[model samples]
Target: MSVTAAEVLIDTLHDWGVDRIFGMPGDGINGIMEALRFRQDRIQFIQVRHEEAAAFMACAHAKYTGQLGVCLATSGPGGLHLLNGLYDAKLDGQPVLAITGMPFHDLIGTKTQQDVELDKVFMDVAVYNERVMGAAHIENIAHLACRTALSYRGVAHITFPVDLQDSEVSKPTTKRNVPNHTSDVFAIEAGFPSNRDLDLAAAVLNGGEKVVILAGRGALGASEELELLAERLGAPIVKALLGKGSVPDDSPYTTGTIGLLGTKPSQEVLEECDTLLIAGSSFPYIEFLPKPGQARGVQIDMDPMRIGLRYPIEVGLVGQCRKTLNALLPMVQQKEDRSFLEKTQKGMKVWWALMEARGTNQSTPMKPQVVAWELGKQLRNSAIVSSDSGTIATWWARQVPAKADQLHSVSGNLASMANGLPYAMAAQLAYPDRQCVAFVGDGGFSMLMAELATCVKYQLPVKVIIIKNNTLGMIKWEQMVFLGNPEYGCELHPINFALFAEACGAKGLTIDDPQHCAATLQEAFETPGPVIIEALVDPFEPPMPPKVTLDQAAKFAHSLAKGEPNRDKIALTVLSDKVRELI
Candidate 1:
């Protein structure tokens, strides 16, 4: 049987256990699309509304499933569209393979339609990028792309020229047809740090009176070890937003997330800690971390580059979180002083109380935190919750009381908007039995609302909660806080997202009144197919920082005095918080 390059590549992926590929089709990928049709039984092709959504879905697939995520796109413009989402994967460290088509090999430098230099275009976002020469080149490129992406936990790209897609392999014929050069078998072992290195880390952790452990996305599978380490060391575990699921919110020791969209207790603990043990986290906010020399540090990470990248750590233990911690446990000594842990625990109680007060507040325009808080209550134990970048992220970070079994993620480093829907869709696809929710702001939802049809088409039961504030809420507040400028160009024209969802043939529900927030969210979660819950939360609800600085206070005052719009509402909202005791 004479096999075309496209078929060869597709078949190889199927052997590698690739069940699906997210993409939208076009003429440039005609041969590849035909190849997919032949192998559709083995590898399902998920059609997305946009190429950007395809890449985002691929990234989310990897995050949720712990497998290789693959997205396909046509030549030129379609490939360009995938860049934003691919960069999201690159920045957040997900394994993804992006296959893009080129116009034709001979069409190069001819300025033909969709004649893109795609390999070069993807160089910045992809760790391993190469262009396929012909049918004989398929195995080499496909194997390398898949392997590199998994090994590096980053993006890999392969560009196949339209002309060569259907070409049958020619006999070696003096060409460099290096055959059987690779195999599908690849494994990333949970390596162990040397006993000597573990001793060094244990000594650092044991010596300090007040120790703090910051867990990031890298710490996802090390929860048992983490709880044990914290118990022995008498340290409180503070999670970064990406690491929210490392230890559930109900775990007495976790001080929640720490940054702008963080808890006050997390901030206080980080500032006061005498020793810091970083477990698979590279939290970027240097200001919120302990002053460089104040806290002696010990960090555990698989990537040595990230171990001491954020803090001046004396010990850098390079290994997987669970494995490294397992090895280090024996050498670690119990710390008798429980004062710091007790203080942080007490602080957590006050923080949650404040969060509860903020979350339950009912007003004409419903509180946004109420939606997140109630959504937290409604989420299935085995659910996946995704948030977009904006004030919605703040609510998700602070209000979503996580269960140990639930998975929570946001667009971490890239902080991209319009990612919630795609992320939820991918999560739903990955695990159809478990629930998936998208917590999106109005501005963010508006950008990718068309994916509502994609959800319906795929029969993915994703609950989308749209915080319907008629403004670009985060940027508007940023203008007031950082620049001390009056809010301008932030207002969004109203769109009844629920009505739009109904029009899209999906279930549509709305909660304009505060009284109906809980019941409406419950209904949304319980509904059968894709449901969009338009929650009319207060646009004036401020996205406050974990701790306010004097400069920030002055800037906010200057903005208000200079006639920031909705000044009266802002004043009432600011003055109304009675949860002021802890700070």
Candidate 2:
């Protein structure tokens, strides 16, 4: 049988170390599907309900595994569905490849049926994007796409015309006109920073009495060294959401996550610190960081572009972070004064205590924090967790204790909804033995609820927890706090998610009563197959900030006065939660 271009493309991907792909099939991409079927033993094909979920799975697979994640979709609408998830990968800097089918070559640009110009569509999301001209073009572009995706730490897209996909042609090579990256898979290794730059960073870190370290996704795999650095400098670490695994919450050094989904200790430390050492985090929100020139800054990043972009740094060290930290440890001086560390640790104690109280309290409608806190309390230390965006994200950030062995991530830069379940599914596939949990809001989960079938079919055994507040809780709060507007168009019609899960041939559990919350979560997590735990939580409970600004307070009050829905309930819930901390 003559070899097709699609087969050749799959072969190249196999050679590049791709083990599996996530996507659904369509008529436009039947050629690629046949190729995947032909070599089913070599590569696993994970079928999903939506192209968007497939893209999310791929992006998250890359994030959790550090491998090139690939998603396949058909042309036109299928291709269009991939943009949101692809954007998540691009913004969060995950290495992903999105392959889509296009209309026949002759039919393209005629505005023929399903003739969406995919090349133009992918321009913004991909670091490397190209369409295969013919069979001969497959091997070269496949190699280039995977290489570029890994190198840039971003998205790559390849569109193949349906007609040329099944055509037979000889491989083209050794021609001068052929592009340069035609060789086998090659690695671009990162080196350590120069001795001078390391010394400069160490000097700034050691000179300050009140120093704080901020770690992001790039700082993974340096837990021990980072802790040592923290001890040496008496600094507490504020982890960005993606880097939650960088340091253990069990350690005295961690102040939890930053930004709105952040801790009071992190807020206080950033506000009062005299020197800052940022590692691998371009944690936006400069307002939350130390004021410029109020503190000396040092940064460590592999990407030179990200090092000094978020903050003004006196010293920027670019290199492999673990190697960089090891080299600089010797140069840094240990501080005998542990006053700052003591104070930070004290604040963390109170924060945890407050979180525990909220988790244990019995409410008419379950509190969102109770769901996250109960889940975290029961999950295995090695378990992985994915948090979807919203007030649920806030609860997850505050209540979940990120152990060093646990992996946690969300749509970091993009902050997109519906990523939690997809990310958890990817995690379950990656670590079949270890449990994976998706802490998702009702609004986010409803957006991609069909993927529950993906979990059942694949037998992924992921534990999905839905905080069912029946509202777009985050947007309602944002409208109140940021715009001083009454909540409008934020409510969602309730769905019985537990019943939906049962209908999908998976285990389902419901916990509307706080009294049985822990037992229900334990039952859901302990079930053998895929399970969804739907907890009906209070929509009125606010995601209270660590520090409320006068402007924010004014805006929130104005919103309530302007007849925000359930304003009295909102005020009482907010006040009670805040008051719990002092007690």
Candidate 3:
């Protein structure tokens, strides 16, 4: 049977195993939408309010399911609106395909009403960008875009001209097929020396009295193997922020996350370890890594470039971490020494106990540490939480413990602000049965506040809890630490978030006192559909269970003694333990 370009487009997606396409229909893509009606059961279409939200949801779907998420849009302004979310997908390294409609071929450069070069605009963000000029090029170009996105695990764009999509094919076309199986061709081409490197890495871990294994999100599917290796070698595992709870937090080998916002136990333990093994973690900050000369380091990663990208690696293995670890397990001997492991565990226990003690006290500004702890208790095993990059992120990293089957989705590598709302939108779309909550700061929420309308329109039941501190708390802390005073940028104007939520047709709640915060959160969670709970916390309130610091304490004293106080008169002395111990 002769086929139209629109029919072939949907058919190609079905062949590629795309189960869902999140988008709204428009004039240019009406033909494609009509073609999708026949196969509604096999590939469902999720209609969203705006193209931006659709793209965000598509990106989240890919992250959760590890599939190539799909989104569609009309030409010009419609395609332009999708850029923010596409940028988010590209930065997060999620595999996605954005199919955009274009103006007629005859009017290519004649400056039509909505004419814009979508391919060139998207080139910088996506890994691959192409325009299907004719029906002859559709089959090959479509397959290439899909395969490139899947192989590279990044965004790919394909634009179809409106006239071309509606035109009938003159000649017969063959259906395109992409090979399902992926090979380790990257490793082979890179010429990674296997036998000798494995032997050397095995020897170093075996010989060292103290060894640490740090993993990241790249190690998602290999959590079990990681735990087994850690247990066998008596080496505890430290996770990157994204890798939190990759293994059950209660597991014996699980220490915590390592970074600037890292827990005291993780920082202290990593600092003391003599040998470090980095498995699939491409953490950006080199300072958080063990000093190059001090620790004997070995890195195992799927991407060859990431192996030695940041910290210097004594040995680099370019393969999946699980595969490389499987090969090395038999070559290495199990260590019987539990001295270092036991010591690290003891330190973690002590830190947790101290945090718990300090967090329980009732105070104004509602300690994020305590609030996050309470929220963690309320969290179900299936709850998926996403946090923005700020003081709120620090609270989530330190206080909220990880549970099995639970995932914390975030826009990493980019460290992008205003990601919490979009992430929650995607998580809700991906896992409809499970509860998805976004812990957003007021500043971060303001970035993409319009998404609330998207949530209401789709009836996605995502709970958004605003940590309303009325200031940019993280930047304020940075000012106190570096410039020796609070800066003008740290101040924030009060927002009526509950009223805003009401205007968007979503349930809303506001809590002023610390005592009512937990119950308010509980009510928000239980409310019918999409709900936003704004906890009006103290703007000048101290950070929850402040970090152990001597420099902070000295700065506090100097500011207090100044005739004209250089800093906010907030009592940070409550964070200090003993005078000499913290430094």
Candidate 4:
């Protein structure tokens, strides 16, 4: 009997080093499911509650393992559900392969059930998207899809028609074109900028008196080179959220995060610098970046198009981060005056002091900052942390210190919620021995909490730290910041997440009092299996921006006058420090 297309595809994936696939079984994918059953020992199929979670797990798996993550879904809604998580991978620049089952080849254009045009649906998110037309196309398509995902460092997709999946390849085609699984077929090389561009970038850096280095995720491989360049130039390094682990947080010249979820010291460094040297970060939010003409900009990015897109560039160096930095380091001159670096370092000390004050506050309901800070201190060196988007992100971004060998991730460009749990689960699955934690808000956790059962089923010891504030904390704060609008539709009904976790067959703990914070967290971490620590955090604790402007203050006053709850608390915590600075 001839090998079916599904079997060939599965063999190709196994050859490509895909040990696992995350998805749910459906009639549309029966052929693939059967193939999985036959290849059970070779490739494991991780069943997830939702296809969205599967996509998220794949994205996180790719991020944590530095390998192409694979996910599958049946046709129609199931395939559509993968878009958000695929976008997360696309935006965050993780390599992922998404396989979707389609209706029978003859029924594709007809009004058959579960028949949807998947190529169009995934076109926006995928770097390479195609549909397999015949059994002869299976091996080549699979190879190309996997290769595209890995080489381009983005999402690649393949839609297999149900009829084609079960079809057998002709003997001649099968014999002439045997599947090849050699590692050399998937090898990719690092990119480097030309000498001319490197010279220009160096000249720009040497001309500036006060240089500020902004590192992004692209700079992860060049930490030593970045540190050397920063030290020689007397530049303060500020990290983009995705770039948090590129350099250790404790570096003498490292300013934490920059932007809305950033530190005042980072903002100060950007504001005072005469030159901005951005490395591998396509950080959006141009308002938070140095204003046009405020500083001469030198941007280093692998993509030539992204070099000057974010900020006006005096020099745009297009190459791999480490290679580019290595080349540019020799061309630039060492700075004689280290005053700007000294001043930024001093400002960082003050910013950290203020953060410690907030974290140690002995308030009634525990402050989220305190929880995050304590968690940071208790984390093992090999820990991987995944943060959900929202107020919890602020705590994770600012409170948690990035250390060497530690991994930190969030739904960066997409800023989607509910990704924390799936991300942590993937990290735990990828590195079973290392500690994995997900910091999620009450609102975000409710979106995909069903995945806790997946964690239980797999016995993945991923700890969840849910900041149960019973509110959409970030939206509530945004309403006050943007429109001075009073909180509306932002409140969430209180949930006993601990009970929910217990129901899902995982360990659970609820901390309502401030004193129980550490003990409960420690207990949850010690649990043998999946655990959830639902800390009822103070809802009134504001996620203040690095620099509060007069306009922001006016909006806050308007929100207070409009009878927003916790006005007094906001005034005490957020405004008091500003008031002190003014006085």
Across residues 1-583, which tens digit of lDDT does each residue of candidate 1 receive?
8888999889878877799999989888888999999989899999988999899999999998889999999999999999888999998999999999998898976999988899998989999999987678888779888988898899999998998998987554345566776776665654578888888888888898889999998899889999998999889999998899999899878999999999999999888999999998888888899998999999988777787899999998888988888888888898888888999899998889888877787766778988888888888899899999999999999999879899888888889999999999999988989999999999998888899999999899999999989999999989999989889999999998888999999999999887888888888877899999998878888899989989888888889999997998887877765343334
Q: Once model 3 is optimally superposed onto the true structure by TM-score, how far is the C-alpha of residue 52 displaced, in angstroms? A: 3.8
Taking every candidate in turn, the Cα RMSD to the unseen true structure, in Å, is 1.5, 1.6, 4.2, 2.2
Positional deviation of residue 264's Cα in model 1 after best superposition, in angstroms: 0.6
For 1-583, candidate 3 gives per-residue lDDT tens digits of: 7777777777777787788887878776766777788778878887766787678777778877888899988889888878877887886677899988778878877998567778988989788899877776666667777777878778999987888886665553445433323222221222343898888888877777788888887777677888888877888899887788577677778777777667666777677888888887888878777887878888887777787887778888877666778887886678888888888889888767765654453666566666777778888898989888788887777777888788886667776667787778778877789899888899988877888888898798999888888789887766565445544466778889999999999998987776886788789888988998887765554443235467765654554445313234464434332321243
lDDT tens string, model 4, 315-376? Answer: 88877889888888889898999999999889988888877776776667678988988888
What is the full ranking by TM-score, best candidate first?
A: 1, 2, 4, 3
- Candidate 3 has a TM-score of 0.88
Question: Would you estimate the TM-scores of all the predictions?
Answer: 0.98, 0.97, 0.88, 0.96
User: Best candidate per lDDT, number?
Assistant: 2
Q: Which ten residues in a row have the lowest lDDT in candidate 4?
A: 178-187
lDDT of 2 by residue, 491-580 (tens): 999999999999999999999888898899889877898999999988898897777899999999999999987899999988877686
Global Cα lDDT for candidate 1: 0.89
Every candidate's lDDT = 0.89, 0.90, 0.76, 0.89
